[model samples]
Target: MKPSLQLKLSQHLALTPQLQQSIRLLQLSTLELEQELEKYLQENPLLERMEEEYAPPLPGTNDTDSDTAEASVNETDTATSSADDESWLGDEEDSNYQSASSSGSFDDDDGDYQDVQVATTSLREHLTAQLGLMSIPDRDRTLVQCLIEALDDDGYLTQSLEDLAETLPAELEIEPEELQIALNHLQCFEPTGVGARNVAECLALQLETQPADDTQALALNIVRNNLDLLANRDFVKLKKLIECDDEQLRLAQSLIRSLNPRPGSKYAALDARYITPDVVVRKLRGQWTVNVNSDAFPRLRINSLYAQILSKQRGSGLAGQLQEARWLIKNVQQRFDTILRVAQSIVDRQRQFFDHGEVAMRPLVLREIADLLGLHESTISRVTTQKYMATPRGIFELKYFFGSHVATETGGACSATAIRALLKQLIGSEEQKRPLSDS
Candidate 1:
């Protein structure tokens, strides 16, 4: 142990602070990166966020652009207030706007945003609104309203009329026939298929409103009895059973396709997810291009007003903070640059997917991209994970482009995505009698 000084050689791995910061920034999502920058801005006196600048619309733009410019001017006009008034962000108004723009109303004045109120209505409410317009007797109206309440979100009264009659108070002496008559009235509501107990009746109710032609009669009979034949797309069986020709069967099929299977789903309050894409891709002049979304990351700069004072006053003990600020700025730039390179490489390899669709996607792996970019597989994973790319098709994550390979019949390989796409196409087009199996 005492002779340890004797010549010995060894190697040890170490990560510099700058390298650690770069890796951390690379792995962060757009929202996480924005939050991280906000934290740094608050802590570092030398760092500040630059204000966003919106330029005027170019001349000779489309009418849509002109409308948007006018709307922007209107927004500015409506939002502006005198200096003595409350600031735009601090509006104390209790007015309520709608969560959706077209649903409800509220005033947006003095340049301040108002809290929006949720204005969703359930199936029951929608039916009740129409029921209020009826001039039926109070007794009949009550029974119809009860049936309306029984209807589910898809506009189907799930319970049978017999079950509904028995569920009513025995002292009221209600009968299943009365409930049936009330249901008939409910079925004739604005949504033609509402209040039906089953899919067959739902479709039949809708077909009842169409022109009373031979085609409508055939369609009505098929929905009420041979609905399964239609679902299986058995046109030959339908033609044989209904004693109809090919054109009549085709017309009936088209009529069936136009029916709403879930009539009340339009009123369902669907939750929407928002995503901020890190990169945007577009085909420019017959060439695919990848560019960083500048708005995805906050613009940061060194505070010249503060840095100037620090420079003149020597030994202010802020040199470490100043160095840290510079490191953050450089690391942020490197993050976007790495993301752009990786995204561009992915788009180049999957260009077929952009032109055609998922079926044309080629097999890809992280190792292949890492080797091409001369970086580690871990770095590629970091660049792909949680980072999204906006393309003409839709917004997709960077990792969505890479997948495992599936062996093909030509002694080659296909991407799993392409295989799945092909399987889906086959399944959709497969004949009912001879459907695809695991084999």
Candidate 2:
């Protein structure tokens, strides 16, 4: 190979600082944007929020109704502001649940302790606690604990006894029969279905504890073998299988319905997330209209003092900060503007969805909205990623309106969402004695 230097002309797009910021702000969800803004507010002294001030009612508005609503909101804002000033983590509602003050004195008139949220006991912990008091050999207790650890969130043993025995130390000589005994002891523990191998066994374990009767026996047989038939709501097959009348099958099914299918799920940890819709949709004059949610973003502005000082002192160090602040405010506004544009485009395309239900949803895609709005497909993708819109039907992610299409008998197409809605409607409306078939 010859040692040579070659130069080729190439052209590429360069992202300017402002364009980068715009892209970043557009991609962030409403919650993330707020957090990012909080970071900028802390770092830049030249940027500040324009706190909303209460405006007097317009001349002809209902004074009493508006005033009362305004007063309550103001009171809540005042209390929240004070609490935040004291401590950022403090809540205004903490006073109700707080039992003692800083001086260690009770706040309540009665001496009863204020109830606070207690930590949840996981499935393993609950079973182990019950195992502690049992009068059994340590080896048996250890085996029971091992089996308890194997139970899943739904309290079913997904692994077979042979499989589990294989996983144990070979030198210990653990047998499937021994494991079965340990499982029996475990089933005797509270939450009767804790060690069940399947749904049928779980229901059977619970039913075994109840006094045996005609209904109990029939329910047991159904759960043990015909659970699938009952789940499909095939009352006709159920009557023929159980060889009983409608009243008898009805009572047996009622008994089975009262049993919990997932016993350990109650111990699972719960996580609650709150979502703020980015836009709201409403039907106005027989047409769906989209409006950006004002509360989703903060009203921001440059600090007036810093701006005036910078204006007078052109060479001040705050010039860069001022420019950054202006960019932040503009980019945030543009972000919401982009969201409103995309949401309105979606609602316009899927207008039938708003008029009827999900069954009326027409096929749509990002390309359509992108071409219609003269924006890139990637830009529309970012806009609909996590942004939510509130409509009369329910709050839905903006992306929900766009889905894969299914060809219809007519030349047009229908959305997969619409197809699913149709299926659900058909299944729901089918007769209970004879449910709809897949064909």
Candidate 3:
């Protein structure tokens, strides 16, 4: 074979750091973004909360004026920290402070934060607390600890009994039934569905607590035997299998629908983490307005103290430090600019969806917005990934706007969001006693 060289022009996606950050921020839920910001603040030298002005505003203006005057006072005044001139760029002088700062946002004064009410104990905590109330011996308690560790966030025991048994201490041989008993006990906890084996079992656990009726039984049966039918909207076969008329079938469907498929998920178990919406939407005078949720986003500014220190590098031949400082400034600006641009793009494209609701959501894709904003598709994807926008419909991730296209029966293109809305509406209006079943 003769060696040949050919050149062709083709584009392939390459993952750049900035694009990665954009995608990461896009899909991040509110909590994830907070953690990310905390991570960046720990690692970077040039980022900090803007220092408060030393002097009060003009004498005549009351604190109420202070509220309206500062459009950017993100949170309630009570949560604001007193002015700190020193920036948090890991102080090299004190190793302990440096170690503490670099690990994450750890402030000695946690008093500045608002008290966010967390509903339930974490899965491990819930199990451990229950374990304490049990009459098990110390050795068995140790075994129970191992068992609890094997359980996943959804409260289902992800690890097999065999795996857990193997992990147990060789001196104390625990039977599988003993492990089963511990699991059964965990299932009886306040959250109800914590120790389910699967979604079917989870729903069954919840339904068992409800009133004993045909609707409940039929729902249980449908979930156990005809999960496929429920997912596919195959109401005819479901009705035939369950031996119910249209109205009864509808009731059964409604009953089943009301049951949380992932029972342990509500708060006790691990559910999908949702991003905080950056912008809030409200309607006034029949017009929609997008207001940035300034509270969720902390006021980020270039750390002047750090900048001053870097400025002092003029006489010293520390070229690397100067270059690093410049990179930090540029990256910070790019991060904010990208976020703002993506936010604006979302507001522009999803305005109708906000005004009219999900049914009116136009078919959108990452490529469409990427082309509009002169960014790569992946960049748009990342930018929208975990980021949220609070609209009149409630909080939604930015990526919610970029729905897959679904063709309607009337030959028009619709978004998956639109279809979901249609599905919800169909289910909502169907005769509750006899719902439209899959036929």
Candidate 4:
């Protein structure tokens, strides 16, 4: 093709390195953000955490000023005062401070070691411990371990015997029948249903371990054949199919319900995460108000002494570092500012939820908040993803307030959250003798 000269005008977006970092930090959870901050502290010499004593006091206050200002503000603005009481970048001196601290020597030459205890165990480890006590041949033990590895987190053996057999080492020359025997032995292990192929089989394994009785027999039969009817709560059909009366059916169901569907879960280690809410909501003078949680954002600042020293030395590469440090501090402040704004908007729209509970939650969308705040929908999503708000009702994720709209009878729309609340209420008040049917 011949060279052609043409001018085209178009607009597109570009994300700079700092902008990309800010966006990534905005979307991170509280734990992840803390980790990111630690990484920055290690890499950037100019960045340092602001200690409580070293932090600057609030505006219009002096070191010699009595508690008069604080007392007066508390008295006049009881509702809004507490919400806006603390500085976002100030170290917490109050008893309600939730941050943890450690006091210990970092010297490795002291020859002191602390033994930390694990609070949870995994399913595989638990099963393997039990396997160690079994009096089986090494070959059989190896086969059982193979089967144990195949069990899912829920303790269900999702793969078939034929499929599992293919996974064995070629030298083992194990058949499907041998694998089935190994699985049978594994199913007999503790937790009751570690090797069951399906929900029915899992329940059956538990029932087999129980003492033989009428209820046990009936439960086994129901689990084996009429599990669908039982699951549907079709007491009438279940009675006909299992040849049992209402009382007997209820007893059988009680037995079945007592069985653990997910036996492996109890042994699974919990990956628990503690959240510090980004904002706090409280009723201030009969009006809901939002306050940014001081603990959620770390107290960060550019070391003034270091900056001054670096400024004295020209062409030392420290100027650029100083600028970067300032940019980071500013970006961190802006991140929380955006979070606070988004949280405030959510609190304003979800006031009813604060007043009455989740049942009063209205329909909301990211677009609505984005439009109101003059931000992009993706930015709103990032702000709301890992952010949380603590209210009088309870702590909830910001995204919890946004739901798909459902049409109401009056041609308006109801939030799926509100509909779920209504459904839960209906189900809770449903009659025991006659459960409500889906209409």
Candidate 5:
């Protein structure tokens, strides 16, 4: 074949970094946004709070002189107003953002450390707790720790016993029999599927622990040899191989679906990071109103004290400090402006969904919104990724509004989300004995 170059016009999805960030921000829960905000504040120090309220002076003066004085006072007030004031352009609440300072810290007095606990004990911890129950010598316990560390998030051992044993010194040799005993003990932990060598073993461990029956036996057999058939429901061949009829095969299929595929994952893969809902939409008088969560966001003001010091200082120090201060203020303002624009766009696109239900979700793609806002798709994606809005329907990720378009049979496009809503409704009304299989 000869190589030739030709230009063709077509559309394709390109995931840019800004688009990725928007998508990520759109999906972030309330807790995550706070954490991000905290990080920004730590890096930038020009942002400070205006704690003192403004009070007007007494009204009394000669006409021309008083007017000039009043005008000057008004300009000063405009320049140094609180964040709650209209002139203040920074985000509604910068302090609400999660930061190391906001998060709990070590108490030297109590000799204790405290941090926001994002997740409960992981799968490894659960396995180690089980090890505590067994009467193992310190050497074997150390080996067990190494083995536990080798297990993947799914609780399958990715390392061989020899590999784990080799990590220890030459004198502290681990026998296969002792290693086998430790492995056996580790397999019996809660969540049923921990410490298996592979997926087949994982399923088998669960099956062995469950109530015994022919269905269980056949399902185990299916897991062992004919696991590939599980994907497309090729039960005819499965029936032939397992020597079971149609009804028996159906029962086995049902049993297998109910099994936990990632047994260790339940304990291990809970959200490592939490999110903070950015925009809160509450229904009032049958209409939705959007507000930023401001519980912890205190008003920020240019520190008059710092500004006075800068003004008095004569050297290069003042110039550097002034530059730093201006940058800090500008960044904070930019962060808020971006957040507000993104939040408003979300409200505009998802208005119908918020008012009605999931069925009313629009066919909004990140590219469409990014084009409208004159921003890179990746930027929009990051902004939307982990951000959320609380609607009358329920709290939803901002990214939830932007779904891939599915062509309709008649003419116009439909959102993939709308189809999923239909599917969910159909399934809810379906009979258990005969499922509503996809066409």
Candidate 6:
């Protein structure tokens, strides 16, 4: 065996530190981006947020002379920063600040933000409060409280009496029969079906409390024995089994439908998620336009005084920090630019959906946008993940516009979302006596 060395010329992609940071900032959601900016502002002495009064004019100035001068100064600064190892300070002078404001304006009439307080009660708390008021003996009350704690969020007692009995303390010396009795008493609590073991049992428990009548008795019998038939909506079979006419069966069904399946859910704690959209879309003149939400982003800039002081010093670490701060500013601008471009492309492609509704939404894929905007599919995915747009209809996540394609009768394709919308409309307007089938 022999080893030989030869020179070969090839190229492979490598991401620089600044480039990696740019990519990371590009994909962060609005809330995450704000937090990242805050961290940088605290850690980096060169970076500071621009006040409202000091905000510079927007980018892309129409002044040709100013643009040329700015370009020359930038080039000179770049060369000096690269070549001078002893001192970053140079004889050349240039404007110290760059504009950080985005291209569009926000509506000043949107009103002030207010904090809202929400009051909520959990299912367990509601049950315990009711249990505390019972006049029963302390021992039986203890057993009932055990069963109450065992009930799930949906008010269904999923654990069997045997299982619960085995888990009881040996000192209590409780039996399965006593636990069953406690469960029965617990079932009698308000929100009628709290301790039921299953759907049939829950419905039967509610039905038993209804006033005695022929219809009530028949409904109870159907729920207790033929709950499966009722769920399948086999009216002909149900009519035969229950010995009732169409009118009576319909009335019974209406009664059954009025019963609550999840009685304890009303008492569950409220989990409200607040969404702040990254883009606001509206009709301008005769065409639709997009604007990045200024309120969601912090206005950041380099400190001019620090930069001036650092320029006069020789061989200081502040130069690297200054470069990092500039990179951060440029990266932030690029992030918003990419987002705005992507948002415009979406609005253009989904004009029909905006004009009509979800039924008019077209079939879209990440590749389509990626190819249109010269971006990677993974980049498109990241951009759409947690970003949202506010439209005239409602606010929707960017991912909501892209869906699988379904073939139509005319050999054209429809989005699965549109198909779902159509199906929902059909079901909603269907006649109860003759419901529409899949065909």
Q: Candidate 2 clashing pairs?
A: none
Give me the displacement of residue 286 in model 1, in angstroms.
0.6
Q: What's the TM-score of each model vs. the native?
A: 0.52, 0.60, 0.52, 0.69, 0.55, 0.56
Residue-wise lDDT of candidate 2 within 144-175, one digit each (tens)?
A: 99999888776778789999999999999999
Candidate 3 stretches with Cα past 4 Å from truth are 1-47, 52-144, 159-196, 199-276, 280-326, 346-351, 423-439
Give me the displacement of residue 160 in model 5, in angstroms: 12
Local distance difference test, each candidate = 0.77, 0.78, 0.61, 0.76, 0.62, 0.75
Ranked by lDDT, the better of candidates 1 and 2 is 2
Candidate 5 wrongly placed segments (more than 4 Å): 1-150, 157-199, 205-219, 226-275, 282-289, 296-298, 316-322, 429-439
The predictions' CA RMSDs to the true structure, in order, are 16.0, 11.7, 14.9, 12.5, 16.8, 19.1
Whose lDDT is higher: candidate 4's or candidate 6's? 4
User: Which residue pairs in candidate 4 collide?
Assistant: none
Tens digit of per-residue lDDT, candidate 1, span 42-132: 9999998776563222222222312110001122123211211212212221122112334434555422232222236666787899999
Clashes of each: 1, 0, 23, 0, 47, 0
Using TM-score as the yardstick, the better of models 4 and 5 is 4
Candidate 1 vs candidate 2: the TM-score winner is: 2
- List pairs with backbone clashes in candidate 1: 79-111
Which candidate comes out best when scored by lDDT? 2
Question: Model 3, 392-428: lDDT tens per residue?
Answer: 4666667778878878789988888888898999999
Candidate 1 global lDDT: 0.77
Q: Write the per-residue lDDT of candidate 6 for residues 105-164, one digit (tens) a residue.
A: 344222111111112456777678888888888888999989888887668888889999
Give the per-residue lDDT digits (tens) of candidate 4, residues 135-168: 9888888889998898777677878899988888
